[model samples]
Target: MPTEPYRIAYYTDEQGNKPFREWLQGLRDQIAAVRIRARLTRVKAGNFGPVRNVGEGVVELKIDHGPGYRVYYAIDAGTIILLLCGGHKRTQQRDVEIAQRFWKNHQEQRK
Candidate 1:
């Protein structure tokens, strides 16, 4: 029997806006954006994307080429991938900080 694919979700801010979507829209590299979308879709379709731990319970989805893009996410309940934020190598530090905050908020809301 085939197992169900993990559900993927984006973090929404207090104002009801999905920050991931906003960040995606603001991406200057269309190719990188396309690749990111493809990776996300593949993950939702049961394929695991390339990622690494970035502390604070956040995982960095590595995107090769063109400034080295990345999507910061958190795995929850072994069934959900929560995308907290996105950024490239230059912004990794700041992005990770934001991702941690988002993940913390998400956990709090679940309680």
Candidate 2:
């Protein structure tokens, strides 16, 4: 177990856009948004069930809710999950690509 629970933060771009939050609101159903947020809450509490690394330091979070929902994020500073973006299984390929770019830009800005 981790010594302390992780903190959840949405990765903001140079233009101050939060992809994850935008994705959440774009969902058709409010319930779906709630479900996704619940999962994020678990992540904040250090309860990530199982995650898959998807390159460029991004990890995939799977939600069995509907249409095989998925979230892309990266662990930073030992205790922060930086949410990059999200998409379902169908859009996964594209989602990963976007996340990679976002992660790279984020790292560059931090430097």
Candidate 3:
């Protein structure tokens, strides 16, 4: 179990939009959705999968999907697991950008 048993949360942009949650809802693959939910559940239970440091305090929770799916996140103050973005391997850069944007907004909100 994670030392902090984090609570999962969707990243909201400055405009108060939850793009990540929208993306999840748009997923048409039922099987993939179930698998994704399982993976995210593990994350909430503190079982973050093969974590890869993506820099700037962000990390990727590698979920083994089609060509590999990823959940970009950062543990805020060690208690909240901010779900930054989700995408497949091909959208790695774009997903990173999304995470960065949300992270920047999150920091601003904290101030």
* Span of 10 residues, lowest total lDDT, candidate 2: 1-10
Give each model's whole-structure lDDT. Answer: 0.87, 0.88, 0.82
How many pairs of residues in model 2 come into backbone collision?
0
Indicate the residue-level lDDT of 16 in model 3: 86
Q: Mind giving the per-residue lDDT tens digits that candidate 3 earns over 1-111? A: 425477888888868888778777888877777888888888888777689988777888776767787878888988798888888899998888878778888988999
Which pairs of residues have clashing backbones in candidate 3? none
Task: State the lDDT of candidate 1 residue by residue for 1-111, as single tens digits.
Answer: 865578888888778888888998998888888999989888777676667898989989888969888898888888888888898899989999999999999899888
> In lDDT terms, how accurate is model 2?
0.88
Comparing 1 and 2 on lDDT, the stronger one: 2
Task: Show the lowest summed lDDT stretch of 10 residues, model 3.
Answer: 1-10
Per-prediction TM-score to the true structure, in the order listed = 0.89, 0.92, 0.89
Model 3, global lDDT = 0.82
Model 1 weakest 10-residue run by lDDT: 42-51
Write the residue-wise lDDT of candidate 2 on 1-111 in tens digits.
555488888899988999998998899967768888998888888789878999979999998877878899998888889999999999999999999899888889899
TM-score of predicted model 2?
0.92
